[model samples]
Target: MSFINYATREIQLKIVYYGCGLCGKTTNLQVIHEMLADESKGKLTSLATNQDRTLFFDFMPLVAEAIKGFSTKFQMYTVPGQVMYNLTRRLVLKGVDGVVFTADSQWDKMEENVESFNNLIENLSLQGDSIDKVPYVIQYNKMDLPSVAPVNYLEFLLNNRGVRHPSIIASAKTGEGVLETLNLVTRLVLNNFIKTQTGRSPAEKKNLVLM
Candidate 1:
């Protein structure tokens, strides 16, 4: 759920990036944090192991355009992806409004990708949140790697859900598709909020869509 502060005229949405260990979830956040103007982003905070793998989560707060009279802020997070950190992953997902599932594209990591996705479903269910209802986008990352799987194959493996959510092919290291993935998820989250709060149709709220 999104937090709305009328007195402060602000709205904060939480977006979590989830995937297997070393799947570029942190890289996506790092790229966004570095590219964005300092005024538009908060300090990038990371709790990582000595080897630099995320131990808990990476947090980056970003300010977007105002919606109605409220300033829209997105608190971006990346869950620790190692299997042993399942508890930490669930804790990070407590109140996410949107998600970006970053899948490792290397062929060797296919099984890990599927396992992490199943873990995601289980955690969301435990929190009483259905994956189908959440605003999310799948990102096949590490595309620049030579051993990456084909996009079509990855889609069948990870995105063959009842409804196909938006998916993007990305190389987080090179910054490809990072912003596109972020923009799409953010739009979905805002659109959902508009529909629920105002009972407005897509046509009625078309103008408010982020470009």
Candidate 2:
């Protein structure tokens, strides 16, 4: 859910990057933080272990186009991908406006990906949200790897559901498809917000896209 502050003319949205351990979730945030200008983004903060694995989450706030004349600020977060951190993952997902599921494309990580995805569904259910209703995107990360699963296979495994979402082929380390993934998810979230605020479809709100 997005928080609108009328007094300050600001709107805040939370977007969480989720996936199994070593699926490049942190890498995605790192790439995005590097690509954004300092003036447009806040510090990239991470709680990681000695081995540099995410211990809890990585957070970075980014300023994007305004909505309804209010500045839109997106707080991007990456949850700890380790299976044992499931509780931390659910906590981070408490008020998510959007999500980007980063899947490890390596063939051997398929089981991990499936388990993480199932965990995501269960966690959302616990939070009183439905996976079908969330504005989300899937990212098949590490596309540059030689022994990765085919895009079709990944899609079939992850998105064979009632509503398939926008999916991207990404190499977070190389910055391939990273911005596109963010842009699409941001757009999806903004469209949903616009619909809720204006009681009209996004296409009917041309001014919403203008800023």
lDDT of each model, Cα atoms only? 0.93, 0.93
Clashing pairs in 1: none
What are the runs in model 2 whose C-alpha is more than 4 Å off? 205-211
Using Cα atoms with residue i matched to residue i, what is each candidate's TM-score against the true structure?
A: 0.95, 0.95
At residue 103, candidate 1 shows an lDDT of: 99
lDDT of 2 by residue, 64-85 (tens): 7656588999999999999999
Model 1: CA > 4 A from native: 204-211
> What's the TM for model 1?
0.95
**Please, what's the RMSD in Å of model 2?**
2.6
Consecutive 10-residue window with the lowest summed lDDT within model 2: 202-211
Q: Write the per-residue lDDT of candidate 1 for residues 1-211, one digit (tens) a residue.
A: 8989999989999999999999999999999997888888999999999999999999999998857788999999999999999999999999889999999999999999999999999999999999998889999999999999999999999999999989999999999999999899999889877777789856576766854
Q: What is the C-alpha RMSD of each candidate to the true structure, in Å?
A: 2.7, 2.6
